[model samples]
Target: MMRMRRKVLCLDWDKRTVRLLVARVGSGRMTLEDAHAHRIPAEVNTDDPAALGGVIAAAMAAHRIRRRDVIVDVPRDKSVIARLPLPPTPIAELPDVVRFQAVKELPFPVEDAALDFVTLTADAERKTATEVLLAAVRKDVLGRIRETCAAAGLRPARIGLRPYANLVSVMHLPGMAERRVLFVDVGPALTEINVVHGGRLAFTRAANVSVPVLGDDDRWQSSRLVVVGGGGEQDAISGAIHDLVVEVVRSLQAYRATESNVVIDNVIVAGHTGVETELAQALEKRLALVTDLFDPTLPLGITGDRGAELRGFSAVLGLAWGLSTRGLLELDFLNPKRVVRRSETIIRRARLLGMAATAAAVGAAALTWSAYRAKAAELADVRKGMEDLRRVVRDARDLTNRSAEWDEWQYDAVWLDHLMILSRALPGPGREVIIRSLVCDSSSSSIRVDLIATNRERVKQFVDVLADLRAGGLPDEPQDSSRPKLYRVEQGSWVEGNTAEPGFSGSTQVMLRVVDVEEFHSPAAVNARKAERERFAREF
Candidate 1:
């Protein structure tokens, strides 16, 4: 089927203004149709959905954007982003695995956040492992965005990260993917920095640095012509520029610390603060790297006086372009991809099969009735046998009363002693071994322990110590000398750690069976236990 042509409206906003871009996307092509920026009055509260949506709606109407569906962006500062190095895992299992790791690093609870991720290129040192870029936003934030959109009479088709969008627009340029580049998007209240390596986003951060917004008409003028209210405003602009440069340097340092071998080839400053030229010059001078202002119109072939204004629309343009070309974005919180567990699929299939079985059983009801008639005589005979068995059960109950006496003398599992034994088996605290959980089952006479260590060797060492304790008698007070083995290692295995930082550690779960050596040695107790086991086995 031929795909329908779509009119894409991309929207993003800051405290000061709401920016909108409209594009025609289809037929193997995407072209920018129009772009506009609507300023929000100082008195209006951006957090109020009704107030913000009115401004957004006005901007859309002025830009002639009739489409209600829009692709929105969540700024870097408004969301949480993390780079996680996970063990080798199948693509089908990535969603669960990513969530498992992301929750540990997220500032907010996973239950309250919307999550999405995209796999990045593997690290050279760990070729078999998968590296993922995880993104999360609080549900409250998304709820507000949806409310604002609803008030503006728009439906949010997808929500994307602004830093990634900026990176995407830059990567669209000729020969950009092959080179290591730093993308700096200077916004009114925040500046986002993204590092691209091997055509993938490697690092991203947002700094609190607000650029001074000059006149609406003179967006692309040089810094020399920027005349603010007074010298204080000018000093504030200069200070903000300096702070932005410092943040860029810090971001570069942070990225290098994580990836020591990477060398940034160039930097691209994008935004329409009118002082981008000066900011780019300052960055280039400070960082000693090639830095230039990002011009969006040149690549899209946008001519006329509007080219300068389009510079600020890089993120929105990228969001539109990516969604248009690719049916789905790599990371979209609105419709994040998730893996369906095999058990859930099986349950669905079982429901259908059950329906079929019910139909078959209904058809066999006549035969069942005939069989019931034939079994009537047999049922009477079984009832007579049950009466006879009842008498025998009465006799057994007398013997059970005697066995109950031995049960009182039987050695019960004392969890406190077992805990002490486990403590002795495990290494001391501050040894890089953390016991996440320890569950004791007195009925089963087993202790299950979950532990995480700094490395696989430590986990294995801990398991070996546990096994040794199971083989030898436990050390307890008063009876410590001749006490028989009180534990038997039933199950143990190590797995790659999902919570390990820097990814070279593992975790292990050990199941140990608790033994009452004293009870086993007592003949009466042994006989009683043996009888109970036999009875259980027979019943099962």
Candidate 2:
């Protein structure tokens, strides 16, 4: 048995910044491998697809990431989330029910929105109603995001809401699972309020709020008078924070008012902008609730500077953690058609490979039988010719000439040499390039290849490399009149609209003609090709 290792890349972005996190998930555990943060330009419109795409591309390049398994945390402002109670419905009919519910609940037309839902609680006996969290985003918004990520050479596996991500992050905190708690994540422009009861999210809301803009090194500090009570800019920011706390208090009261049996026992504050002792103390004093700075990474047994940055990455961490552990929340807005297309492509490839192998095996057996019959006939003729010395000598000369011509026609190393040339002509590590299919014509000595890449830049680079290879510019391939020639190049969309596979959306078609085989027949070239094949086989 072999253990499967899964690597997931999670991204969270807001108006100010985009954060990238990579984690290796296995055996019910997740390990954070890398983290990066890129600030958006003040002039760039975050809503513009082209602008955001460039930023995402630069961030991915800066982080040196090549993996495509990604989950993005969309801004809470762009999404609509609601908790709905519905009569017991069969699992198979839930999608239709959810879609119908979304049409009524969403502000926009159902056709213009992407909808998903998760059942939070259900009665086992199917006698009572079930509570479901329904999420919706406008199609235009989701389409723009999809296009932008595709341009950046990424196709996110899931698009998660920030509030749900935050809930997943703090739900496992000590005493949190057993008690009702309010998780307030204060961001730069918006504050997310999530209420967790019995380890499940009961309520969530996002309110516009402003907080102090502090740098990484700036510890939250205010003059004693300002901390106590003052009238200035710092005091104004404090006032804003206090107002946010008041909103949380109101939401808590409202939740308790409706559900009389539930009471929020604690308030947990977490986010990049407002995870300070001052804010927590203020909330505790004002709300008369036990308030704490929520750092969920502590429970994962992570420490040091990376763990310290967990406050800023609460949502992304939750996304990765939930994916690893298969948590209850599973909402993704990635187009279903695209997912189905990818699956179909994979299945098609597998079937094609199996068919090709079977055909090759059958052909080999037929060729062997034909060759044996030809050899038997030739032997009988040779024995007959042995009765006459002159006939035997004449037949032997004919046979020698025929064998020489056959040897010239069957250059065993031609295909191997062509493969080696292609391997050298393409981008290697750190480049998002995939050769989807390859075909060689023996009689014409031409190769046709289908390639897909992450972005246009990489595809252009591949073309340039092919041109160089054809010109024999590389060190290993010497210049000659009979060098390989580039015949045709075709570039097109690998995946159109939102139905494209991640990291494989840019498509290119290439044809190369191997004009000469004399070079590959040399002893040194044959030995080199043999050694390369051996090494490849060992690695495989």
Candidate 3:
């Protein structure tokens, strides 16, 4: 539990004193830092348009108090009130049911009644007990008070019945130490009596104080506290006190029989304008129970600079204590409209952001994984390509080395001498004038020779030489065909120029790629292309 400090303003219309108590309940001590109490003006006309509750307001201002919880006692002449029954239902659903019940129960109709309920307790069976206090004050009385409080800069957070408040406050004294206690508050005209047994309020009754008794006594300080409301002449006051004491003795006797579990040990009197010693002595004279004056800072457990000052201001202290509980009394003192709306908005925003963040994280993870896999695949492909290229380069290097070691000079002389030999092997040479350029394509294993010729008949001699070479077992095909067959030749147009001879201006080119061939030394055909080329060359 956290430390609790609150400024409470209290007014007893009977006593006509406005009391300010700033009390803090902490470390098992109630410290009263400041205390201010003031008497009301005799002829202030509290019922006037601007007169009601003015004295208490002035005390608040004197203390420079701007905000506080005020607990004010109603005068004796005021009879307007309401009480509601609460049970067989939950505490949270009380307001709706209160509205429904008050409509019929309140003779003035529910709308005219200002209703507020304080739930006393709820047993384990879901049976709730509530005290619904309805004030049926004159509209003018409320309007005047509202204007006065507003002008005084006092915001009345809770307006409660004086009798109920006194009862509740007296029950929470430092250490009264009684399972069953009696709380009696005497006002100017009416006296309120309450019995709190088993830590819950059992009864509340209001009676007229026909004879008032004023005393200064210290005996009323235990389970029972007498509250003598202040007013009247000396005779009037003395008579009121006697009448109150008699009634109090009868109540204790009746309670002991009805509730056999409880014991009445002591009587404590809380005076409005009276003393404790005189009141305590008078009570002991008539009743068998011991009597004492009420001192709320009792049991002497508290230690602080202001502990003594806060004892009398228990009503205001009770107001703060009431706030410390969760879901205690259902009062509209707290404006919950703004709180509920803000909470729902915050929760909705947080939920939306949480879902969006989850989805984004999942998507980013998937993309990152995909990129990693793609890079791995690309690296594998590059590695395979490099390995194949390395093999190719190694094979080419081996082939170059072998060629270099075997007959390098002879190979150069016969390097492309085969093309020249083929040209010379043509029958009836000198038809085609010369071979211009020969290109050997190793990729396709084909040889192509460009020829500049003088006559078309020289092409026929070239074709005959190719036929003879093919029959001698060189790879061959028919020389002339419509298609460009393998090992076949095609003649280009005559070279554009002077017609040295009819149709003898252009060159012819032969293109072939051979995969199989025959050796000329086999003698399958004499004067093979290879041999015939040597013979022609010899003649030239």
Candidate 4:
């Protein structure tokens, strides 16, 4: 089945302005369908949920966007990002590990923070250490964000950090992935300096530096006509740009001290302000690094004056791209709630399917009963003719057999449900174990699964879990003892160096025969099993 393209509205709000971008993302591509910018008055508080919601609603109405799926970029002022090294652990255990690191690194209380992390690197040789990028924002900060978005008649799906969003927006630029570069986003109130090395964020710092306005067009023309006509104004702008460059230089020096092998080759300046060109030129001369104004819209085939304005929406575009492509930054404060909602949706869908199937069965039975009654009436009339009576009996038997065959076909269609069960039976998430391949044969009433794990112990644990699930003992149900066992292990084998993940050293092959096919194939049983499996999947 072809997947439907996602319509996403990305919102970025600062003290001065609220920016909105609506786009359709699918098939590894994103198209900007509409955009809007609303300026907030200084007298009005942007933090006020009602005030902000009004502005967002106006923008959405202007753009004719009714999409409720919104991804928001929160400001960096109240959030913290840290890079930490952890002992080699399974991916499932990273949350606890990150929370521990956050407790030591963050200035605020860990209990009051919403935390997320991305794995940057894992040591394959030793399998003893891993590096991660950790991000945390206070719960209240996120609560306000949610409240504002909610008031706007929008459902906030994901919250992203602005700097990280900027990084993703520019990372795909031509020649950027191959080089270590500094991404300087010069905004109205603050400038973000991000050092990206090897296509990953190595360091980031927000400097409280605003772009300086030089003069009006007439004043600029008069100043160009005479030497030192607007020297003071020019000097002020230059001075401000110099301060930004100084910060960049300090950051570079600090980063170089730790990573001597990687050198920053260039700088990319991006923002909505018109001073970006001047700032880029000034930084190039002062820092001795090749600098250019970053136009993130270039890769999207956008040009002209409007393309320049699109530069301001880079962070929102990045957020949409991440949503479509499942980017590296897997941080989402709303993920747990989303999981619950998704499970509910799945259960509702299952119920609807069950209702439809039952209706179909009832209709089929009604038709068969009417046909049987008519055939019996005809048989009574043809009782005097022996040959006719035998033919009518044969026809009735054939119709009954066809109905039985239809039911059998329905039973065989529960293979997908069995696959769901097998998925639930495995160890997942933070565990290093993964299922490499699954092959189910309804004819043989059997399934074969190939699994990989970081070590042999995890593989053994996986087998035990599968055994428990087959015996209906894994969920600890009181009725499990009476329920029929669903599967019997037919064969098992383990091999080294048969896995794809870098840290995993071995793979296991297991084959199981379906023992209680009747219960597994029942529509109600399948639905219940699927719901339980989905719940387990969410927890892990």
Candidate 5:
């Protein structure tokens, strides 16, 4: 048997077969240099999950290729991606908060889907205050990719979103796009519109800009910089192409009126060079300069044939390219090993929770028996005290039960430090969490909180985000700010990765302190510290 090599196989809805330049280890990237392309014979159903199995089996028999893990790029038309805010690193424990938010966020339901996320902003610190990148691809579309991989005797690892993959490939390539360069991806079933700035995919939206060239193009790129698909219906395509450039120029004009400092140099289109040039010229007439699709020479040293291969599978190729780093998948988003580990973690937590419940029941039974014994002995003393209390209650009737209410309030008091940090980190009313148990040592000021989550993975993610906040030099406000301090998540209990055998285990925790709010505030503040404090505390 040949050694299993990690490979990325991309087959679009149009049956364009592409083997992206991806490696399991070493310098893996996208290169059109070793461009390999083949036409899938119609004898197989491309949409059928099991249909691709025959081809995979055939490839192993013929070429000795025997890898199982696969990454599929879903079609743009069928997928939806939205950019949403992420909480401060500490509050980030609920990473799945975004997933829950996606239901209201996406036009379609995201529950029956396999999703992945990419942090477009390198500085997660900036994200601590607002939103993070959330790209979601529907499960049905992902199933197609999974089906193809399974049929070929391979396991589909992640069905990556198309827009994110394209954005990564576009930004990494040679030359610079405007701060908010409009990205228009004209696919067969749909047209994708996105705005990228600071090398991150920010705003994303799509419309049925495919059928007979009818749809929304308000956010589309300069129509002149068109990326014609294989089904190029000349008139429909050209008209759709022209509309984008017009919108781009109009957007520039509006932007200039408000902010004269901003500059948009030109239009850059990628697809068929022959079809793009005409569109590029149309854009150049109105704007600065109109460029072609993408030049892959930036990351991948493409000379001739290498560059050609990327012309079609740039997005898929880019996803596989980003994965090549660190000897595994980047961001660790929905990776199999990680997924298996995460699933195991969820199971272990469930088991632990059940065990704890059982133990508590047993302990409660024991306490009940002990209390019964104590009650018999205390009955005579309580009767004598009750008789004396009747006289005292008549003297101070209003004070009755007030002591009990005071005791309950004392029990409900949250730790001051957690209260301070959490108040600053709340996700607002529309986004909030109910904290279960927040324990703080009154004397030592040590804090340990336990939160019940819809899933442990979400809790773990929230903790990770909290850690990022301090790392980003964010405020540790309402706490000590003398020499500058930063809060961090102390590692919590983690589960082992192995199923039958155990491997690495991990956990997450949090720490908060007081700080001065000098540079953090402005005289004419857009964000009030007190209001933000309320938002964060609302969750706790």
Candidate 6:
């Protein structure tokens, strides 16, 4: 199937004239169909889009060009152009990194500007940094251009920088890729200089220099020099040409200072200001480099009466042809290409949402764990305080018990009553039994007695008598009526026979409990104490 051809209207303007071209692009080939230049009326305000667009609309109508979608060029002075050197980076990440760096270089706030860039050097194998051409224009400036196009009943498809357009147009010339060339486009008020190195734009700058034209009212005609046989006109033209040359030389010095190894081999000049011939000769003589006038329509076989007039149309022609051949130039401020977000795709968006949810859950779990640990620490502290209080209460109760026991000691017969009980348990005048040791502890309320006897039978008899006295079974002796009565005997009392020595065949030890005689002398108390001792003895 034959591809349908698309027609594009290219528009560019300055304070003097509005330049327009219509081209039909199809099957990778672009043909210029029509071209026209509309000179602004001296009374019409060029700054007003409504007034300027009326001239553009009338020009389009007069040229018989009906293409509505146009590609526009912003003058070099209207946009800020910069060449940024960046670290070696991948193509996918270049846009973001370039924008980040471009923000720092811009004179105005980035938010109010439209930005775009093209990478000039992106060789990963060279291990060298990447260089990109960055272009930014204020949104308000572009808005005015859009308003102008709209007023002309045209829709702007792309807004591109004029310097890059000139660069693209010049690169199409034969043998420009391998050599470094300085491209100069001289305008009435502003002149643009572009440095093309290795088929890429390296540097660009605009200067404020005006070229004098003889016929100021000659609308849409080639600019001609006024030689009225007068030195006054000649001197003024020569002075303007000299100023243009000086600006070109300064631009060359700047480019060379930065890239000393890359020497500019040729100077290509493009302008309709009839002085291009004079300017090229001056640059060649002053800078000592080959210089030539750039005719953009020549390569496309566009010549004849219209070719000379189209010398100044190189930037607009390049803007149209570059879009046709390359689909889209690297720099497109109308709709700039940016990094694609993963969240733009549904599957990637779902994954990102899942990751966010997982992070939130983990954070909540961490907070909950921290709260639990804090509460646990507080509970432990409370338990410790309770335990300390319990210890203090126990100590106070122990002190009370010790004080009551001390008071009992003052009223009771101290150790004398205990000695009397032990004497009564002895066999009369050492008849086969001998007392060995007697110990009494008033604080603990107990007595321990040790005895030696001739045989185990004598030891048994002495223990039996002590037990009987504690139970009140033995009759009190008449001589000791004032002695305290025996109240208790401990079940721990026992006798063991020792046959290791011939003199002592057995040994005995008895343990007795001291108590208040009046308090425990009742029959019921005595019987209750006897039952407890018997039960203990039986268990032992």
Top lDDT model: 1
Compare the candidates by TM-score and give the number of the best one: 6
- Model 5, 127-207: lDDT tens digits are 343455555656666566666666777776665666666666666665654355655554433545555666666555554
Tens-digit lDDT string for candidate 2 (1-540): 012447888888777667788888754567778776666776778778788878878878866888765788666678888877777866555667777777778888988888877777676676334667888888888887787788778887888777777777776566676777788877777888888776566788787877664542212221111112223367757877778878887877777776787766888887665335677888898888889887765666666344435666778877877777764446677642112223334445555555654555555555677765665565555444333444444455566557655655555434654576677767762357778788987655567877777766776776666655543234245555454543334444444323155755556677665544434455686587668555644543
Q: Write the per-residue lDDT of candidate 4 for residues 1-540, one digit (tens) a residue.
A: 112356788899766567787788765667777766555555657879988887778767766778887899766676898889887866655677778877899999999988877778876665434888888889999899888888889988888888778777777677787677798877767778888867577888888876543322221111012112222366667777788888788878878876787767888887655567778888888878899777655666565445556656667877876766755446666652111233344445555555654555555555677766665554444443444444554565566557656655655665675665666656653468787788888766678887788888876765665565533233232335455565677546668895767888888788877666545465786687568545644543
RMSD of each: 27.6, 23.5, 48.2, 24.1, 23.3, 48.4
On TM-score, who's better, 5 or 6? Answer: 6
What TM-score would each prediction reach against the true structure?
A: 0.60, 0.57, 0.48, 0.58, 0.49, 0.62
Residue 14 error for model 2, in Å? 0.9
Scanning candidate 2 in windows of ten residues, the lowest lDDT window is: 218-227
- The collision pairs in model 6 are none
Candidate 4 regions exceeding 4 Å error are 123-129, 212-236, 336-540
Cα error, candidate 6, residue 256 (Å): 0.8
Model 6 agreement with the true structure over 420-480: per-residue lDDT tens digits: 5567666653657776777776555567776777766766666666555532223343333
Please identify which of the two predictions, 3 or 6, would achieve the higher TM-score against the true structure.
6
Global lDDT of each model? Answer: 0.73, 0.67, 0.50, 0.69, 0.48, 0.72
Residue 76 deviation, candidate 5, in Å? 3.2
Candidates in descending lDDT order: 1, 6, 4, 2, 3, 5
